[model samples]
Target chain A: MKVDPRGQRFAAAITTVVLAAVLVSASPWLLALQAVVFAVGAGAGVRHSPYGLLYARFVRPRLAPPGELEDAAPPRFAQAVGLAFSLVGLAGYLFVGAWLGIAATAAALLAAFLNAAFGFCLGCEVYLGVRRLLPAGRAA
Target chain B: MAPEQVAGGAAAAAVLVLGTVLALVLRRRSGRFRAARSRGVVSAADEAAEGLRLTAEDIGAPLGERATLLQFSTAFCQPCRATRRVLAEAGALVPGVAHVEIDAESHLGLVRRLGILRTPTVLVLDARGAISTRASGQPRKADVIAALGRAVQ
Candidate 1:
């Protein structure tokens, strides 16, 4: 599916805020809430995610249409990466220790902040990096 | 209010600053063409050893008479699409420049051999198929024209 890159950035900005909040408060419930957001984004699609819906309804109307649309797979893969980090963070907070949770949340926040502020999608980079490493001749 | 809350606030501020600084550095570097090692210095034997020369067969397209804007792109990269438009326009604007885009996903071996780390990686090749300059990430049209000047010169 094609998506507006701006909307993805919008979602990332929201994710940056949410992950930062998870860090400052060290709240497992809030972190869990973000985990669900990631799950929906990954499992369903970015278009169906709450932040995406918010952008579609509220934010997109105020701005010009995107100059171009991009494939949604990379950002969706990024959402899965976020979900992985959030799950690890939840595990850390609920079972392991506060240090692990904080570290994981901080990592996720760094990634989201990069996408939000700079249009540098760290998760997308990782996705491409991993694809580069796979055995050649396979369809990506 | 509390000591812990104060520390949390400070940490949050620190994270924001760090992200901003890192983004600034990356933004400054991204999409700027960097001249590769001077192809003039490399002896014929060394050039053969390095395999820096790409042929029309390797890229699945004919080279331009003056310069070729050879781009490596992946399936899901957003900038690659934009880069295609920019390079195509640039190619068309100049008389002897041609743009060729390769699917980096399908050409993993070639991508690894060239040490391409990201999508929208562009190599400007002169008539001899030697790489003159390259940029990783989306490049501006002006920079591309400038790079072609160096390539064709």
Candidate 2:
């Protein structure tokens, strides 16, 4: 299914806030909460995620319809990327050194901020770059 | 309250500030067409050595009499959708101009050979198939028209 790019950016804005809080507060529980959000986003479809539902219910109703719809695959893949980083961060917070958690969460925060402020989807770009490099990806 | 907490807070603030600066720089530069020779992502020698001309048979599409807007896109790129609209409109508005969209994922060989680093990378080819200019990211309509002007001239 296709998604409204505006909605995706809205979700990213919220994500930027949550990730920033995690980094500044050094809150393991908060990061764990965000990891769950990423899990739902990746395990299920993006439309089924909490932020997606929030955008659909409260935010999207007030805005004009998006000019163009984008394929859900890229954003979905982006969710998976976020989930992976959160997991690494969670591991760092729970078991490893605090520095590891800070670094990982900081990286995720950078990506989220870019999407929120500039509409640049780093995860989506990584998805395309990786696909372009894969040998098996040559076939249509 | 602790000394470590103060240090951590300072570090986090710095990271966010740095990200903002980087995003601003990318925003300023993204989607602006540049001369193919000025591309820094791939060495100019690579493209120069391979020859800058593309054939109709090579891209699996026919060339235009005056100019061709060749777009390399991927399934997951949102900007590619917007870009398709701009290029298609330009192609329709201009005489002897054609817009051809290539799936970058499916054309890995061509993508690598041409040093295409991202989706929505547009290559403006002149009548003889020499790449005149290219841009990575979604370009404005005026810019697309301007690039076409350079190509068809």
Candidate 3:
């Protein structure tokens, strides 16, 4: 769908931050509802992200590289792994209570803000790190 | 559980669900609106003519001879629209303070020349045209005002 990486990242970050804020301020049931809403929103974003799509239609022939032109598709597995980490962080806060929860919440908040302000995905970095540790054939 | 606690829990749950749903719907709608395109390119020399190509001189003028608030925006930035409102209100509160907005899209060449990568960037310029502070996202009105005061002083 020709989604810009920057835009996708920004969306992801905003979603994560809002989710975290909801978790912090809302009741348990409310948090669950927010999680669902965030998941759907993220799913929609994934659908639109143009990570691998060709851009032949949008740009001039001279401006595009040879062969198929598609928008860059964000790495799905990588993004999923990032989302997973964010969930883990949130869950840790929810289950552990107070100090631990606040710590995890802070981490998630930092990750999200970093993605927004600097376009750096902490979750993606963690995913890549874990992926690197896996055996060759086991890596997704 | 106490009756009050039960009621509170239910209310909280309702608020959460409603807020999440509202946020989701808003996000979905906002996605349809794309950010604005960059303005025509400007040369290095042209950028030099203006201290910063992303900033507009007229808008940066002091607010009624008191304060100056400058907002850097792109044509299609939703947050920029919100930020503009906040600045306008702040301008109203303080006498002699002027709020200025610059469209990055309108001056794409200058933006590139100045190495701006993000839209809706705000820079509070002092009376002398030097940048006092810069914010990449929507800034709180109080923070902007405080920075402006600092810069003016």
Candidate 4:
């Protein structure tokens, strides 16, 4: 299945806010909340992703149909990447130190910001790089 | 705000500013393709096609009869879908022009060799498998047509 590209951007916009809040609050709890958000989006398909639902219910109805929809795998992979960063960052803040938490959120913030503002996919590019390095079809 | 709070605020602002700048640069670069060396000669298509070398293995699929609009895609790049549609439609309009979409990761070897830095990168190939032109980002219909003009000349 495919997704409206705008939905991904809408979700990214929300992520940018949550990640930015993590930096200001410096609270493990807040970061954990953001991490859980990532987990849900990554675990469920984009159709069930909270931000996706938000886009479907509130945003899509207000706009014209998308020019075309994109494949689901890449965005799903992107969500997995986000989940990894948020979870690791949450771990850093909780067990390691404040600086790690700040750093992690900063990284995630950069990615979310790029997607929302510029439509660049830093994590998606990283996903490709990783796939290139690994032997073909190793896990799946 | 406290000293720590001031520092955090500064970082937050920095993220936003950097993001804005990055967006500007990407916007400038997206969907622009380099012009081919079309000499306006009737046989120029054959000349361009001479140096081309691609097969089903290179693009993860077979080439079209007269030309191929080979597209490189990734699991996460959204623009690839838009580019695919344009290429597909263009291919249908022009006889013998075929569109092939390749997963960047699956064909990483060819992707790296071709210097494909982003998804939706397209390589317009002539019938003989010569690379006629390339666009690094999601391409517009006009540009695709122009590249096809060069490829199918």
What TM-score would you report for chain A in candidate 2? 0.91
TM-score of each: 0.90, 0.89, 0.35, 0.82
Candidate 4, DockQ score (0 to 1): 0.42
lDDT of 4 by residue, A1-140 (tens): 87788898999999898888778877678778777777777788776888889999999999999996777777777777888887877887778866666667788888999988777877876666666667766321
Which sequence of candidate numbers ranks them by TM-score, best first?
1, 2, 4, 3
Q: Is candidate 2 or candidate 4 better by lDDT?
A: 2
Best by lDDT: 1
What is the fnat score of candidate 4? 0.44
lDDT of 1: 0.85
Candidate with top TM-score is 1
Worst 10 residues of 3 chain B by lDDT: B30-39
DockQ per candidate: 0.49, 0.56, 0.02, 0.42
Q: Residue B46 of candidate 4: its Cα lDDT? A: 58
What DockQ was computed for model 1?
0.49
**Of models 1 and 3, which has the larger lDDT?**
1
CA shift at B61, candidate 4, in angstroms? 4.2
Clashing pairs in 2: none
Task: Report candidate 3's fraction of native contacts.
Answer: 0.00
Model 3 agreement with the true structure over B124-145: per-residue lDDT tens digits: 5555444455665566777666
Model 4, TM vs. native: 0.82
lDDT of 3 by residue, A1-140 (tens): 33344444545555555645544453344434434544543465443433212222333333534432113323233345444544654565457543433343344445555555544444443432343344444211
- Where does candidate 2 stray beyond 4 Å? A64-68, A132-140, B1-8, B38-51
